[model samples]
Target chain A: MADVLLSAKDIKIRFGGVIAADGINLEVHEGENLAIIGPNGAGKTTFLNISTGYLRPQAGTVTFLGQDITAHLPRTITKLGIARAFQIPQLFLDQTVMENMLIAAASRQGYPSGFKALSRLPEASEMERLLELVGVRSYAERKARELPEGQRKLVDIALALALKPRLLLMDEPTSGVASSEKLEIMDILTAALAKEKVTSVFVEHDMDMVERYAHRVAVWNVGKIQKVGTPAEVLADPKVQQQVIGI
Target chain B: MTRRIKPITTAAVIFFLVSAVAPLFVSSWATLFALILAKGIVVLGIVLLLQAGQVSFGHAMFFAIGAYTSAFWGKYIGGGDILLYLVLGGISSTVFGLIVGLFVVRYREIFFGMLNLAFSMVLWSLLEKMFPYTNGADGIRVARPGLLGFVFTPETFQYVILYVSLLIAAAAFYGVQRYLESPLGHMLRAIKSNETRLEYLGMSARRVLLIGYVISAFLGGIGGTLVAIIQQIATPEFGFWTKSGEFVFIAILGGGAHAFGAFAGAAMFEWVRFYAAAHLADSWQLILGVVLIVIILYAPNGLIGLRQRYRQSGKRGR
Candidate 1:
């Protein structure tokens, strides 16, 4: 009976003829690691977008920390302690990793300009800690564009974590990382999430990672949740197995 | 290029010494002073616009606004008293900047650049069309601007006026540089790089750009006002598209990222224009075009890039 941090009721999103997300109800509790696993085009990303304020649902009410943030601006919603990372790992490529994380922290603190932050020592140290947490501390001085795929993903996660957010919406955090490196990155992410006690509803295609990391698995099919339960329960459901897993 | 020690210090020291003693070389103190002051002011606006990776092609409109404000006030009310003209000119430019920024900052990339040029040209055309009050092509006269109650008729006194104004502009440039290094400026760079990510971070891209736009315009207005006072005329030419192009050209000629780049660019721009006009006359644009093309191709960093390369070479040579 944990307190819910994010609660969405009957959310439906349509893109002309295609319904990206349809009548879905989901909740992520405080300090919980929730996974939304689905096949391609299941509207997993759209659901994440609606929850993070990037996309507005046609019908739904989203309450985060008991506040109705459905109509709030994306920046305002982020300020309310919900942070997200894109699947493609968006970063200021010309900037140093330290500079990237520092800006992220400043944005979270509502520092309007970089001149105001002025590369303060404390901010620099905080950036170092974030980099270390995400296992990219050695790459702090490197330009973001120079980093490899795995490190870039870590930097993206570090930026989201820099916000010190209570809830994180991650889109394919492990996407593009080598198959061997996926578990390592997930392990680092899970440890950081645990340390911060941050709740997350992340989308991933890897079932093994989901089973290993997800506290609760929500299987989505055709923009709707097919089942929500412990890994074993959801994996056992015949409808979920046939429609979602196709096993 | 690459950062080094010895050569950089030597170059900086030489530049500083030359500028400090430059006023002594010219017999006409007024020309020397006016040359530095006017160009320095214009460069301030260019610096601000370049911060967000934007090239403003219509700063001349603000310059024209400032010049007109000073001239209109100087001619009618106070005869262009130095103090009154500058204040009035700054205020007018600030207001115009806020208005134009509202419309211009919404556009991005080439569309943003094009809108600025179009807006400036519109102002120029309007000023020329409403010739009855603006004097159209004839231009407007400026009475000798004064300090306090004393009018500056002496060449030495005019020198003081220009020098003081130049100092103020320099200080303002420093302030802007400091602002650019702040968190707000970083976000602007972030916006330039990936605005979508900024939106995801919970900040509006447009609003941030608007703030930068208005600030740049305010500086542009200040430059225009200085030019009006120095030239003693306010014309529709001040708001011309070519004038805006001049600012963009100067900004690019100077490394947009460097604090002093715009100033160096402006000084070089004015000097080159003077040389081209004196020597090439009708073909001056051809020479200017060649120089621009060369810089764009080989040294895209402009003067700053050249300096960096020179220093790096010196280090390697050693």
Candidate 2:
């Protein structure tokens, strides 16, 4: 197996008597796409929250590249080489797609200060290249609010990728996208992640995407990882088939 | 239609020169223009705050801080150099801004405005109730400050303040326009758009807000100092809640997020009020209130947006 890039040990969280994550331990190996599949309220995103520093787990230690980042801030985690793409596509909607990329670029350059020309960043070409990688180069001049849903998801990912994260966490990359466009978004996402050689952990509901993109599958059920295996091993299980995929 | 910086700047320069020389021709309007220019600086600060979707309803506290800093300096140190007063006054307000901003920038929308209002009210009460030191409601009388080392008489002082206020207003307007095009400016817009994404990008929104707040405070302070110099006194009314309202009123009247709008709004606000008070003293407030309502309803984006709409439609017509 590849060396672990991020390890979460004994994670626990509860929100007003409802346990979101409890005694959950998972390891994401370097340079592999890990899919987390769960039903509603299973805390797949909660795990992402704890990992990304949005939520500090009540009990757990999350270490990334040998650093204990369990309760670190989201921005700190991002600066420490872990970046997240929101399921709802959090973006600077009024700004152009290229401007969004430039913001991401500016953030990486120490949260940006001074009167440096935004349109003429030194890494402007690099921003263009990243947009091209995510297939959003054509919409670079377009406002983020004007992009279609699928393109919004792609740009969100592209913005995350601009941080040059060693490990990328995505909370349902295709949640709002049309079903007809799901596979296309997944294709672009997978291709981009593969090219970037990033270790990714994504919570997904689409079995087709999970089967196609994920190297390993972790089934989350009520604050615990019930099973973890290769996609074939996990998806083939009778319980997983019944409880998760509902096949 | 396009914002060609050089032409606008040249025009602004000419406008300022005209205003500076206006006292030579139309001396009665000079003081009025001087007051407009000073308040214009304050509105520009509000414009910067507006760019980040923030409106400091209590910003007059900084204005008062600047005003008071100069008053206190004149009272204690007897420093008359205009540059010294401006520097000290701006620094004093900026320091207070940094302190207040550290707390207020953590909030958003109404909370931010209320918190700023609360702080300014505190300053206002201190100035009003503290009779021993602050001189209560009568305010502190300040001697006329000088430019360089020359003691300015009333004759030279009016021209001194008029030209100085015009110069600073032009610089601030141009600087703010330039700043709005910079990366940090874009970051301010990003904060307004989605702070969550800003953080995930490894930047804190609170930190960005604090910086903007500090800059706004600095501008407000400078404006206060200029106005105080022109008035030759610092009063509790400087930090009053309604005074802050007037700043917001001017900001909206001028424009939202457009630097030029702030100046235009200040000019219109002062000139209209000055003339209307003389002619229609009983109903001037009513007329201005009606004007604000109309602007909010029809031109909600403010003057700049109105101008842009006309220009774009004119092009379409062509």
Candidate 3:
């Protein structure tokens, strides 16, 4: 069995009487492409939030790399080799695309002397390599806001990869793209992830994309995982049919 | 529209020349000394804080802390040695910054700005209310220092000391610049752009912002201490909210494009204030207000915006 990169046991997050995440147990293995699929308000985003240290679970432990990271800060968690791309493509609108990537790369390296980073040299080359991987090297000089939605998503992915993270959490990675382009973005993502052997746990709504890309699918309903299995098994499950497919 | 000069670089170079070498040409000892130390150092602090996407309205608190600490130590504790006074002032203000920054960092956007103002006002009111320690409405005075156990009655040593202190303060402010332009600085900018996104990336916005806030406060203390040495008196008005507001104005005027924008803003402010005082002292406030309004409306990014506009237009023309 592949070593579990992230293990969550009975993690619960409550909003007053409503539980956003209740007794959710998930184990993400290294080098796996896992998709968490559910209807809106099924607690998929909440699980990602808790796991990434954005929203801490009120009860239960989150262990990453065999250590309890429940008490760790988000920056520390990121530094420990976990990076996330937001659903809305959180690029720095004011800065150039290259500058945004440089910031991400800087965070990974623990912030070297300012002058060294500012001077174009070895770090600049490294920046180019990452941009090339995302196929947006041409847009390097453009501000993030100027990039198309697909390109912005690419930039976000480049930023995540800049950290050289062991785990990549992507929230609706193909969001805002045309239905036809969604698969193409995922193809680009899969190729990039394969190149780095970076494990990805993504929350995606596209059933076709999930069937084609995910190694396993976990169906979430209300605030619990209704079913977890290989794409074929989980998609065929009656529970998923009622909660996710809504048949 | 491109001017062939980047605003950050232009502002930095201009301020550097003025602060570093302008005193050489100016023969008026009083004006030259004030230009180098009081105005220059205070403005440098403004530049540092604004770079981190924070605008301070409590810089006067640090400024006052520097003055008061120096006055108290020189008058009571250390027998008025100028060097000792500066050191003591810096130490006291740093301590003040750490305490105040902890509470202030919890706030965001406008609240952060207002909290700094409130804190400065608190310090100002406390100094005014505590008559015995601070001398209330009457400012406390510091005795002149003996030079290395030798008295220099002619006072040329004062000028040398002022210049040296200003140099060190300028260097310290530059250190802040180096940090801001670094990855850490980019991280702060990222927070400025989108704090929630930073959180999802496994970075804490609170921690990053807190460090920036503390650094700003620390330099504000240093600026304050420099002011104290020059003035020889510490008063409650040093902590006034208006003085804090002035730092904000200066930060904006300088364009906050680079570290020296604060200095440019401060120098212009002092120069204008002096010029107005000479010609129209009673209406100086009105004149200053109108100038600020014009700058804000015409140049929202201050001088920095002009630099950006030039760069963008140049690119287009090319």
Local distance difference test, per candidate?
A: 0.78, 0.88, 0.76
> Model 1: per-residue lDDT, tens digit, B124-238?
8888888787888777876667777775556666565666566666566667767766777777788768787787776777887887777777777777777777777889988
Q: Which DockQ-derived CAPRI band holds candidate 1?
A: medium
Report lDDT (Cα) of residue A73, candidate 2.
91
Residue A67, model 2: lDDT of 95
Looking at model 3, residue B212 earns an lDDT score of: 68
- DockQ-sorted candidate list, best first: 2, 1, 3
State every prediction's TM-score relative to the real structure: 0.93, 0.96, 0.89
State candidate 1's DockQ: 0.65
Off by over 4 Å in 1: A111-117, B1-17, B28-33, B310-318
Q: What is candidate 3's lDDT per residue for B1-318, written digit by digit as tens?
A: 123234565666566556556666664544444544565566666665565566777778888887888778875676666666667777787788788878887787678888888988988989999888878978787666654565555356556555656676567656767766666666677777877766655566677776666666666666776666666667888889888888888778867766666666776677777779789969887878887888787777776566666668789999
Q: Please name the candidate that would achieve the greatest DockQ relative to the true structure.
A: 2
Candidate 2 lDDT by residue in tens digits, B1-318: 135345445555676777777778877787888999999898888889888898889999999999999898898778677888899988998999999999999999999999999999999999999988889999998889878888866876788889888888888887887788777888887888898899999998899888888988999999999899889899999999999999999999877656877877887788789888899987788778877898888777776567556767799999
What TM-score does candidate 1 reach? 0.93
> What is the DockQ score, from 0 to 1, of model 3?
0.53
Sort all candidates by TM-score, best to worst: 2, 1, 3
Which runs of model 2 end up more than 4 angstroms from their true locations?
Answer: B1-18, B312-318
